[model samples]
Target chain A: MRTVTRLYLSNDTSARAAGAGVLADAWSEHPEVQLIRISSRGAFYLEPMVERDSPAGRVAWFNVTAQDLPLILSGTDGTPVRSIPFLAQQTRVTFANFGETEPLALDEYQARGGLSGLETALRIGPDAIIEELQVSQLRGRGGAAFPVWNKWKVAQQARADQKYVVANADEGDAGTYCDRMILEGDPFRLLEGMLICARAIGAGRGYVYCRQEYPGAAKTLRAAIQKADEAELLELDGEPFPIEVVEGAGSYVCGEETALLESLEGKRGVVRARPPYPAQSGLYGSPTIVSNVLTFATIPNILSRGGAWHAALGTERSRGTMALQLGGRVKHPGLVEVPFGLSLHQILEQFGGGMAPGSRFKAVQVGGPLGSLFPASQMDIPVCYDVFAKAGAVLGHGGIVVYDHETDMVDLARHFMAFTADESCGKCTPCRIGSVRGREILERIQAGSGTIEDLALLHDLGDTMKVASLCALGGRAPYPVLTAIEHFPAEFRAKLRT
Target chain B: MREQVKSVLARVRSKPPNILKALLALQERLGHVPTEAVSEIASALGVTTAQVAGVLSYYPDVRLTAPGRHLIRVCMGESCYANGCGRLLRELQDRLRVDVGETAAGGKFTLDTMSCAGNCAVSPTVMIDRDLYGRLLPSQLDTLLERYK
Candidate 1:
């Protein structure tokens, strides 16, 4: 009997964008080759990366095209997947299932330690689950860095007939794709995480408010939810815990927990004033547990492998691994899940493989669009929440976008302001109007028609937006601009009218 | 148009009556939500027309006006911006003879921008309808555009 060959390819959004779909179609045409689709290993630069199971383990072929099918089928040219420096030199907790199995395959998911978290949660119960989370020292991965157990505790304590577990998959941040990666790749993991959260919070129903931009993730999640429901994996105390996938309509502000609840209720994605926080009153005046996709994705691991196990990694305050996305002008732009304390310099140099050839790193904008810009001089700062905070920067959403020497800091500042102005919900004067004024001033400075007074006015505007704005959208909008001006003063000064 | 909107709205069976979902469903089925169908949608979703209009206007996804045959969304996200997506945008504007957020003269393409679609690894990404094209160059715009028409 002749043995058939099995091949693996990434179905990740980035991989597909890099032309995995076309390659998969080409490979499928062959009768001898059995094609299997799995999630990306987050080594994005090498996508359309194909892997074949060898006696030595899974060997990979990088940046494959439809034309490379013959070479891949022959299994003549490839490196062991784990041997790749990008894949080997990192700790993957949340994304461990990535590149291992087909995203929706429940059997494969369970075979590789999938439902053990839910099983643990079921055995231990809600109070113990919260205790495990507290021990884990896990903070919200969605910019805020708030303690995960605190929010779960509030919702678990709150008295409500209809409570909710909402996973904020509205990853609108420009340079971030971790949430999308989780949702698209190992969606069952996210479902398991949400199920555990529901079990902890005493919630009957859950909703994943995924962004409209990620249609693929939403579709994948919906399919995963259906699969889990059929397998009876979403049951809490022998009752069906229904989880629905709700799509966000391109609103950046909706990423905020309160605003997300508002949008989930089918209203405009406007920022809601606090006091009755989502943990207390959310999703139609009911107690809700709103957490980021990464945060929820992390819960399963913390549950399965004791919280102390997770706490063992990382710094004193920020525990466990963070999925850091490296994009823009980097040689090996991809995602790195590491214990939080590695310097930006180390991450950029080691995992990122430094800057792209012929390009020198000017600055890196950590977090997201609202994240602060750090010069090469500040690259030594450790990737800790407190460390980044002390440096007057945000570790928001763990998106690090590097800019080369060709980038104009002044124009980049203006671009951030423009994004804020465009995406602002217009509910507040500071974000809606101040953002526009900030853009105009930056434009004037860029055109060499601005005086020193305009710079001061820009600072004044930023300060007001920081303090008075309703939500993070308005409040944190000035971060990139202010940080750009502070770090690259010469660039801003050069743009001024002579 | 009213019947089409009603049919689309009827499909949305969520308990709380999702206005966003209804609007999205309507847009998905009809290409664009018609003004005439607003009343039907409002009634079906148990919302006032003003409320529906407010939601319709708030989101960038749901459209009030009909888009061109093919929709072209250029990602203006930080990663793409850093990789010279501006040049690609300019080339697209020249080739399509349309500015950002406007439909081309012949209605072949509608040029618009998304903050990000999380495809930053392949910077300077563009989406024509549902098909995503990445690592794009300004010189490649003409050839890419030729596929849709």
Candidate 2:
């Protein structure tokens, strides 16, 4: 049998998807390698990748096309594509291996050290895993600053018959892509992360419930799961543990932990009362460890590198890496993972490439809509969780959306209020209806309505939602509404009576 | 078929009332729900076709017809709203002649309004078939839509 070769030449979105078919046809003469494929996220820059299964070892390298496929398949070794400057510098902690290897091809994955963390776990026990994680000081990357160690510790200690590890890929938060980027770019890393979590907390099952908005992510995950199953990774038919992907039905509240569990149970998404927590009683009434995709995705890196190696990445109390989803009025917008405590200006200017050249920076909205809007001068503020807290902004989801000069902060407030209103799951009264009421006031303010009393009304509405809402989705739904009014008072005042 | 479905659903220990999980499992396997799934899912969950159909209808993302080959979901969320998203919405309507939630006639293009892409500064953005188009404008949209055509 001839050792055929398949090459993934690109990470350009459509090209990567389309090239798989091209490779299948290219290898028609020699089908022993089964399939040689290419994938690009349509980035256009990284094209012409090659994957060959030679006797020496499996060869999966980038920058080769079907035109070059014949030569490469004829056993011509290609130059490493990473040596190219433009393609080489992408710091892809999330998308590290995506498009470079076969998504479902387990042998390729295994050869490339895909599930080594799981293999390492197979050698060790859960408590050691927790110890390694705590030493890493890896904080939750899904917005909140809750220590990952504590959450896992709670799940580990919770008295329950069964524990679950659920990945909240339901990233309906207005400005977060750490989940989607990881799931689409590096599917196995996330799978390995979940498997590790299951192993850590004595969980027998895990689910990666992706939000309805991310079709590409959902498709990629489905493909990844079948591959994992075919490789005998997931426990099936009396096997020990099974990992699965649960597609969400397009609800923002489902991104909330409790609502996610309800939707998982086939009920209308509504938040459960807390304290018992999912650690106490979660999906299907089992003790569950519900973690955001970022939190879960961090596991493989933490385990492979050890905790101190990770703790070295960020500021004190905000240790480890952070994947910042840079958005809004910025020039270069995408995912950038750096150590925590990077200043806002450093992110906006250096990382974001500074607000579309001509645009003047007004306010940068951090963490999603529920997060605060920082005035531009405060761009010097460090982006650690505590620093953001002192400034009334939060590190929620590490999403940085910039607003330019022409953009009115009042209009921004209205838009955030509108999103919160539409996305509220109707479980809690404040977020359910209060978001609408708040949105109406925002509308009145934007449409040039009401007296100064509207500001007070906005404040009151925000306070009520904060005090009474079941989950963070509603509790902080009013942050954008209140913060915009407090910081950009003139915008709201402009709408009020003379 | 019910027996086959029950056997399959039993693989996950799904209860009789967990119709959503069952339908989702069907969607998971079939990519999208098939009309045939109504009968199979109902039978599997010990419910009726109407019950299954009713539940499918509740989910905004579930498709009765095959989804478009290329889905362009423009983020109409607040961050997008503040940026040139208003113009992008208008541009999409002008090009596709359909509002958010409506699919295009050709089935190649479906323009739906997603709440957020989480890439807000890159607002006025449309994820064409999940390939994100950041910092989109009327001109940029013209450049992008022409590719599909």
Of all true interface contacts, what fraction is found in model 2? 0.46
Candidate 1 per-residue lDDT over residues B1-149, each given as its tens digit: 76677677778857888888888888888898877777787878787999988888899888888999998999999999889988888988888888999999988889999999899988889988877888888888778777776
Q: Estimate the overall C-alpha local distance difference test score of candidate 1.
A: 0.90
Whose lDDT is greatest here? 1
lDDT (Cα, tens digit) per residue for candidate 2, span A7-44:
44433232333243355466556554445343332222
Model 1 misplaced regions, further than 4 Å: A1-3, B13-15
lDDT of candidate 1 at residue B3, scale 0 to 100 = 69
Please give the C-alpha DockQ score of model 1.
0.84
Error of 1 at A185 (Å): 0.9
Candidate 2, superposed: residue stretches over 4 Å from native: A1-113, A235-238, B1-13, B22-58, B62-72, B94-111, B118-123, B127-136, B139-149
Interface RMSD of each: 0.9, 4.6
Assign candidate 2 its CAPRI class: acceptable
Over A177-228, each residue of candidate 1 has an lDDT whose tens digit, in order, gives: 9999999899988899999999999999999999989989999999999999
The C-alpha lDDT values of all candidates are: 0.90, 0.71
